[model samples]
Target: MKNDRAPFPRREPSQVTGQRARPQEVLGLFATVITVVVLAVMILAPVARAATSSFVFVGRGNGHGVGMSQWGAWYAAREESKTFAEILAFYYPGTTLQAVKDPDTVLKVRISSTPWKSNTTSFSQVDLKPTVASGTLRKYASNSDSDFTTQTISAGVLVRVQNSGGKVRVTVDDTSVGTFARVDLVPGGSGASEGRNNVQLKTTGGTTVDYREYWGTMRVQPGDDSGELWVYNFVALEKYVRSIAEVDYDWATIGGAAYAPEAVKAQAVASRTYAVAKDGATLADNWADQCYRGYSFEAKYPGIAQAAAATAGQILTYQGEPVTAFFSGHSGGYTTVSAWSGDTALPYLVAKPDPWSLGAPPASMHSQGPGWNWTYTISADNLSKKVNGSLKDTSGRTVNVGRISSVDIVSRDTSDATSHAKTLRLTGAEGTATVSVLSFRSLIGTSNLPSTLILSVNGDVGTGGTDDPGSGGDPGTGGDPGGSGGGPLLPGEFYDVGAGHLYHDQISRVVVAELMGGYEDGLFKPEGTVTRAQFAKIAVSLHNLMNAGDKILVVNVTTKPFDDVAIDSKTTGDTSDWIAAAKKAGLISGTSSSSFSPFVEIQRDQMATMIC
Candidate 1:
């Protein structure tokens, strides 16, 4: 009989006298117990194992990756012996290289304006005088409300203008000439019409010189706000473009070698094209439009001026119109669509492979541009801090989110022959959110994670120690699997929530309330000052988003509420509609009874009160 229970009971020992069991029965019991123990171990081992908790981010590129890559152009020109036209053609495919009809056309750039700084009730005086080396100077004023009249003035004559109690006072040669809201200065021979004018004045050395020799016209006007003066320079387009190129591009020797002249020419054309595409009503003298340092910049960088002259009148045109030429410091290994860079899609502004970025000699050779290939390491704690901020939507609405845990690249676009992450998945302790790759880059710090072209993400979730290094390969040829011909990803549809800001909480709250939105470049710019026009747009958007009332009609309005709010007014544009609507709703009042002071800068407290 089988004795199951001896020392270790396997079976009930046949209900016999257990003390008298044979050694064989005890052995049988031991064997059966060992078998059961082995089976138990096999079933429980897998359940006790550990899980993976880390990830890393491997990426490439440095900018929005749209249009031309400065480094790539340099490489093509230096290594491949390509011309500027060839480089432009490669980057802006299907676009025509054309020449401007009037290269000497003037650009109205607001260089120094105090209006955006104050809206107080104080007053100030601004003195403007035109001087020429050999030509006579003249003052042009609006004869009728719709026509201009001219009056000859002596060269080097002082014209004093003052803004007091929301009215303008004008005086010439210390005598009261007239008081007008606006005035223009022209050469003696030039007509009163708004056009290019010249002046000549004697210098300290007693030498007469042309006004263009010193730069161009200097127009002074009443400040949009109190105690301020708005000064502008009506500069020739070529000169303006040259000034920008000198400041933005590095003309210094690199690795004991000079930058390719073709690259400089390419930049000149691109910059000129961008300027031409703008409406030219009021271009900023800085990067808001493009860096313009006046005659000082042109005098400093003679090489930049030469490049501009070489590409004089040349611009990239699409279907008979100037195309919006976009460029950046480096493309990493690929270029992206204009839409990826907060711009609308165009036939010419498409992404393409950039082999020059990879084929060029290493950074040690001094051929590679800055940010060509980069790396960044971020810890989990820091990442959490970055994600718990607010991002504004396209509709000017803000969305505040919580701490971030994991980041995943979901969808990609390869329509431009290069792979770039279009959509990003951000997981937080509270919930998960999805955003455009561009928006994510902005929130994460554009310098930290420069571009949307990613390779991998590796690390422990929510616990830091992630490495984001640029990938290595031939930038021109490598293709990411399943990363081409994808549908366009709209950036305005997503929000950029992150940390490292002073007004993070307030901005996040306002964005969530749908009262304000981020710039197209994907920055909330919490510390940036807002103009009256900008505030008007925000107010109107807020009222509409919150469905405040039907009192304000933002639709087609034949009449303007303020003199400065008219369609043809200096500060007029899309904001005019919003200003009109807000005025009709009694949500906003003018600086004076008739003057809206649309260009004045609004303080933070003022914005808050207006919103409330």
Candidate 2:
């Protein structure tokens, strides 16, 4: 059955075995969509299944299918005797390798972060731009000059930092050291057993408080609202590269055992370059960024340190600047971009063939097995739970599309030879949804699906209740895209939008609510971008919609906070009062103190922040 996707979980066919519904009836929110939609495929943010016992998904590769494929590189190095520079040249085409101008750059690698107890969404923090959410951000600790307190710490003292009474407190030897905004722990005394890089860091999560060593200063910083702290390892660039243990160093020993140091060296360069690229941004010390194990990982395989030193300062540069070198565990056969990062701006990060990942690995390749290919079978009931549990709508709420019926591979990425599956359509009793393979993988564990590079699917699902249920379905809620039942009818001159139009119902809702209106020509340009002034009026209307008696008055005022606004504030379409009122309500802002830029089209982020 054909499914026109509406933000991930699309509504079931609008007709159910015993009822009819709308897209909002299924997913409960309005959002722009991702992924391709075909007769067999679609995309989503939510799901569930009921008709079948289980569907077995067999897939290949691991990690996001973008940038370098580790197995591909390893095979090239081990079999083709490709040099590190040559390997890098092939994987990161159109990039020049340059020596480091500064080898000691410090990277703020977040080694540990506290969990959000109430957050059950499937998407990880890495999916968002700003990784750390700041809570009541306060001024510096009264006794310290900076938000992070470290210089005054006693030499070799064991420190435990935790949130206390909304203030972060540091304790040493079971005695309260002080309450501050942040704490820096220096593992000294016997704790510094593995030299500078091998100092162990004990965490509170484990029952016995297990520790991991790092090669730099460990800073514990408090988060916004939670009692949790984000621990970072402020390590130097070279040392940080040496500390990465993404893959074992033993891959250097091939069948011939002829100095094949290229693979590990290439990894060092890639890892270093990625860190340098993300120098200012928050980075997790895991695969979410790069697997940085610090001193402990370094100690386990000393060869990695040698490899890092050998490729010291070497980085992949595109147009003279270091590129955000992304690398994955394996590519089924080719690498493609994940939608989270736009591909247009990053020309180097595109889909390309990688014939190497398909071949057998060398005996010395370690855990990278041909056995990496995997199959996982999950029951329909569990599939529903897992999908419904994590697939969050754009509003960041979970909408259950009761018990899934059928799943179809709708589209594939035609950019490269791998032609990885791009979208999946899921049908359920409550509704139907189509979601990107990337997002769907999150609904089901990545460990289960591995990558979107599906070799084949070997299972079946019952037919969804697409057949019309007895009687017309229940009316949709506020989220209904169809503006039916109780709502003011649009003027007859509004000929553009009719019952069959895509946004006919949605347009009806806003028009009926009186938040917006048709143009002079009786046309509602639903697809057009909204201007700042236009949005201002909408914002004011929104405030008034919620506050019936107390509406924001739009009056004529020559003197206002902004000088660029027209003198006659209340003239029809003048926008001055709307701007003033929205700004007064703290729902909008101008380009600057004097300029409203009222004619400028509003950006997406601006709308998000104002709505938030």
Candidate 3:
């Protein structure tokens, strides 16, 4: 109270009426400021860097970064605002987009249907021999005997119906079991068909044996029962197959003789030649018939020798029986062409020769980075009527090559990002060419696969014993494991509302493209836990389906009953978009607390809730 009016009474080293600052206080304030600055740098630096990395730098853009950047032309076009045709010409350079003058002249082939039959015997074929029980039988004394009794012994044969088709199907007995294409006989067990029976036939003379009839169908070959013949251009197919076989055989002989007895190599070549040269039915005589039927090498003309060689390589077994050398006329394009060819069974004509690699193919333009240039040449040897080619640049300019094949391009830019879009376009050439490009972006390419071959056995092993051929043929659409052709789809294939983040249309389109119009379920149930990892896998599979090599996203949002979810957590970057997209689509929802509970055992009801 005395000091209330006198600040100087207790103030020590104070300016006016204020108290002096402590040294630690001054240091603490300075430290706090420094810590915030450091933290900001730590957090913001990465984010800033990532943002800078996503951009695609611009450059001249006819699909040929070197030859004609169409976008550059388009830039020129926009400056002049050219016609679509003009735009095409600006990038294409020498090519012309002509109308199909005689489309019908070309032959088209498609697999109408694939039918399968079981080659294995059925349950009815087992030989069940009759055998009397060996146990002692007690016969009672008759007539005067007061007590009489008879002891009868019983024995059973074992039989089991093994559906060895390697596929799950509801059997005739209405039980689901894995069906194998080839079912072997196990014998002596209770099965769908009873092959054993204990019974005595009474005849006027004495006791007689009883016969039992067991019934079942034999296993058939795939694509046979339905009589769904896979049609192809008879002449063209024969030519292709023969050629592949011939090439394969010749290569094997030449390549192997260097390591084996000369006789063995010569024999292989002779056998292969004879097989292609034969004229009738058996391998010994079928060459002429094959040629007449458009399947032999000689019948295919300039294609004959090549076809025979190729066919021999494919069907003729080497000493080691390996696939022959896969040559690519095109250098940079071999890996791409081979991969696609292997799948479709398409033939590959190498598109690149050595030394001329001027740059990267137009397809690789978009992926190029700063300070690089590329040039490429494609060939016509690999082109087929159904195929079309394109040279695409990162700038969104695609030089449509139609069916013609030779091309070349060059490109350059100051900045690496800006350098990528330069390229060249070539058409009408084939056999091999070179492409060179300077770039930081990885190049990507694709090719088509060759067709498959199906061999069939003669039909009609007599009638009556066979199952009835219904309105649909044997092994009809109904029997297909992939699902019946031209019928409604399955539930699992359907789009469940609210349960998935994907739109029905988007999923349907993908399904149509992939599984080809068999996906069924239509409704979606939001506000439920999505379970059944199989279902999750399928849901997330769309990312790969759409973009091929890109990353995917996956997430879970359900109630809190499950202890797996952590608050404010996220999946890694690669799949984040898919997971987030799913969330945004109303396909997923959190548990009871409204927060996505990522780790919880999904219940059946929850599955239904999510997939509804």
Candidate 4:
């Protein structure tokens, strides 16, 4: 047992069962929960945003919108009762799960490389501290890991390899150790890959790209005899597989109930299979390959090791060869084709509906992060900048447009209930520009767009961007103020706040100016009560509008004025920033010295005082 950190109950290699008879068709696999899944999906909130004139996009899923969606697997296992093989078969169809012949095969995993010196094209040196929990450290002059001699040293020995005088110079504890063609830092006299204890690699102000403590043997060999070295953590395939932190294993603690274990077993097989397929120095230690955080992650999440152990020697094979199964965080609502990324489309990697990713048992909606069905509103000006920036580097595409006033979907490629944007047309002052949805996402950033699968501009958008912030079209220019019930209705006013209503003009002007807007569901809810926090945000916006040259922006929002108003990372911006601005403007004096009745309904006099 590893004594480094608290771990889950250890399971034997054969305990975690692999491969059951796969259902014939995809529909049959999820048929048991089909009705519930569909019904739950149908009630999902339609894409809505505040009545702001920005280009609001409403969509589903996240990640690259392809392969096995982690969110979908979570719902299928947690709520739908699907097993690991069943989930794997659903995402990667036409594939079979099989046990591998050699799970203990050695794997050279790239942990990270030393930073390339600036203003030069090559790396100079690497500084790493070698240690072990039980075994001593050794500087192997030859590739033979077990051939330990006088070079064997205790733990906490700092080793630095420098490229000087046409040879790899080795310095230990600030003294010349020796120079050799290949420098191997082994953990005791153990075999390079299958070791009893791991050689921990710690950064002593040397590496920056992926700076973290690592597991297994640390090997430093010249990349190509150019005095350049490539570093790797040489661990047995099983140890490397067990440390892949791909999904949220700690999620089981939610509601004091454990999440399904089979989902992680499925991931273990996928990660193991993906790793088994790679060779040479092409693989990496990031999401591009798979997030392999080595020992520390394995210690923190014992479930990862448990899953890998359970699925040891298990891999997904297509035909006879093992498959490189691709998985991602979320898939909006559908798994897409590899062709969507300009890669060779595989027969089994076709598009499929991933309803579980949308949400199931609506009560638990967004118990996961905001990836399910999310909304992002970008102003016309910002969209134009992203479009031009993307086109600036493209060889064939050129941008003549200034500020984009329109964003329209030209085509969509969907698998089922959810759709992904394929082509988008942007219109601006000078002219128009067309961009593939993939290119657009690459330009604007995935953090904002998340996934093209759910790209719906301006409310499941359709075509064209909104002329105003709100997608309800114009909020009407003309209305009889304080009218009991008179005058012709103008173009586009809130269903409740119309020409017949009193103070219609006042509401229209405010909505147009974006001083206020309706809920995300597009409802005015005029009769709804307002809290001090809500009114504070509005007052600050009004102040900014009046003082455009000196726009009021409150920095240091971490310093809170009211105890009730949250200022943490979850609520870092927007309302929090404006709330601080409101307090500074004397618009809101908390109910007492420290407490602000942020959620309590504001009285008419309090509203009147805020307006004053």
* Best lDDT among the predictions, by candidate number: 4
Model 2, 1-612: lDDT tens per residue? Answer: 000000001111121133322445323212211000110011110111212455656555666766666766666666666678777766676678898667768778776422111111111111000001111112247537454433333333445556666566765546665777665444333333422322233333422223556665565556555555556667879988887766545554333343346778888899888888875786666545666676656777777888898888899888999987877766665555553346454756655445555432432232333313445566777778877757854344564778776676655555221346666666678886666677777777676777876544432211221211111111111011122211232342122343333444455555544556766533453333466787778778756655657778776656764777775744743677778778887877777668877765555455554442
Error of 2 at 293 (Å): 1.9
Candidate 1: Cα lDDT at 494: 13
- lDDT, candidate 1, equals 0.53
lDDT of 4 by residue, 210-256 (tens): 33456566666555555566566777788888788777766333342
Off by over 4 Å in 2: 1-54, 113-179, 185-206, 223-227, 252-260, 343-345, 360-371, 379-405, 415-417, 427-432, 459-612
Using TM-score as the measure, which candidate wins? 4
Cα RMSD of all models vs. native, in order, equals 29.9, 26.8, 34.1, 19.3
RMSD in angstroms, candidate 2? Answer: 26.8
> Which portions of model 1 miss their true places by more than 4 Å?
1-60, 102-104, 112-162, 167-179, 183-214, 246-256, 279-281, 338-344, 359-371, 376-382, 392-401, 415-418, 454-612
Q: Model 1 over residues 1-612: C-alpha lDDT tens digits?
A: 000000000111012232433455434433443232232233322221211222234455555667777766776767677788888877777678889866777888765322122112122554555544322223334334444444555666766666544445667778887666555565332333223323222322233332332256665556667645455667779878767632234432333354577877888898888888874667765534555655545666666788889999999888989887877656655666633335445766655556665433233333222224333456555665665556543343443445555676665555232356676666766776666666667777766776766544441111211222122222221222112221221322111222212223344444444456665423343323456776677656545544534435566555777887766344433567788878777677777788877875654444444443
TM-score of each: 0.53, 0.54, 0.16, 0.60
Candidate 4 residue pairs that clash: 52-469, 52-470, 53-468, 53-469, 53-470, 54-469, 59-454, 60-332, 61-332
Per-residue lDDT value at 108 in model 4: 77
Residue 609, candidate 4: C-alpha displacement in angstroms: 14
